[model samples]
Target: MGNANCVFCGCIEQASVGVVEKWGRFDRLAEPGLNFFNPFAGECLSGILSTRISSLDVKIETKTKDNVFVHLVCSIQYRVIRQNADDAFYELQNPKEQIQAYVFDVVRAHVPKMNLDELFEQKDEV
Candidate 1:
């Protein structure tokens, strides 16, 4: 016979939040600090979902409207929305990669429409 465990406890760091899942499905969000869940025969799982806002820097080589090739380095700040933390974790296999893909798409679509001079002048706008 196997020993049965009843309680599982974990801590969420101050800078991060957590997600709890049971039987491979999302169960709830855990706030910072110690949290507990029923093991229910080893079906419960929990871990940190996200910390504070994270920054991603991407370098892109693109052509301008004037046909000039330019290199751009962009920094993006993002976080998993508190309400959608579960979706952020379960729905997306790699959130960082997804954000990078979106960033590349947006830059490619818009940067080519602006001249180098326009791009430099309104850098913050982009």
Candidate 2:
């Protein structure tokens, strides 16, 4: 028998929330604090989801419209919406990779249409 008073407790660290799944499915969310759940029964799993604003820098190498090969470093800042923390955590297995992929896609799509000189002149527009 599982210990009655030995239930698992999780602590959602500062600037982060928690996603609790019951039997391999999402059940609810736990805000930052001491969260309690049953672990011995294998009924629940909790994962911490960060809600802090963070930045990602991606280095992409691509050819410009002028056929100039260039290396560009793009930096973006983002955060998981507090109310959408569950979706962010569940929908994205690796948030960093997803962000990087999106950055690469956007940069490649826009940069290739502009010459190197235009790219520098309209950096903010891109």
Candidate 3:
């Protein structure tokens, strides 16, 4: 009864792709245009899921050599790079999680090598 637009629907609907599945295990045709669907639907849905490139923004604070604290915000965008859509989804949950894990690892690996002054000077390198 809820007529909700596809969460992935956008102006680029033309470029949209479809995923064939059952419709909530309910043996009923919810909509038209479904290519492949399980007729006897108990708890399944035929839908198209979209995977898009995502970015994560992280802010890190460190003290400067002059004893002043500074905060740095880094925005990083990363995609699955892999062409396998299913594999990418199975491997990477979402953009935020990927970004947080990657950025944290990167910052941790390099932060200790530099002091506050060096950290400030090399901020852009990150």
Candidate 4:
């Protein structure tokens, strides 16, 4: 059972219950009815990096140097180690918009830095 004051419970009640995956790691768990969350559970995800707390994810796709048109996806996970739920919510907008903006900014910054030939020639550099 969760306390009425619990943010998780409130979110479940007021909004839709959605599963949030950490960096595409862990089977997305129900957003509702969770009691205390242990960071140890983070290990359940083999390739995904779990944050000590809940985090945000960002993904993007772009073409390769050879114009190979490769799809690239990236995710960034950030958690509030301070345990301030209010602060986290206020600082980071809901995942979708925030993630889109972050991915775009990151991709845009990196794209210009590399030339088509550079990307193809230095395959391992990136």
Top candidate when judged by lDDT against the true structure = 2
- 1-126: candidate 1 lDDT, tens digit per residue: 122223577777887777776666667788888887777644454556665889999888999999999988999999888788877766888777888889889999998999999999988987
TM-score of each: 0.85, 0.82, 0.52, 0.40
Question: Model 3 segments beyond 4 Å from truth?
Answer: 1-52, 62-70, 80-82
Q: Which window of ten consecutive residues has the lowest lDDT sum in model 2? A: 1-10
lDDT for every model?
Answer: 0.77, 0.80, 0.49, 0.43
Clashing residue pairs in candidate 4, if any? none
Candidate 4 C-alpha lDDT tens digits along 1-126? 111121222223222232333433434433333333334443121111123444445455665534554455555555543334333433554655766786787675665566677765754544
lDDT of 1: 0.77
RMSD of each: 4.4, 4.4, 7.1, 13.0
How much RMSD separates candidate 3 from the native structure?
7.1
Two-way lDDT contest, 1 vs 2, winner? 2
Question: Could you tell me the TM-score of candidate 1?
Answer: 0.85
How many Å off is the CA of 27 in candidate 1? 1.3
Residue range 39-71, candidate 2, lDDT tens digits: 655545456768888999899999999999989
Better of 2 and 3 by lDDT: 2
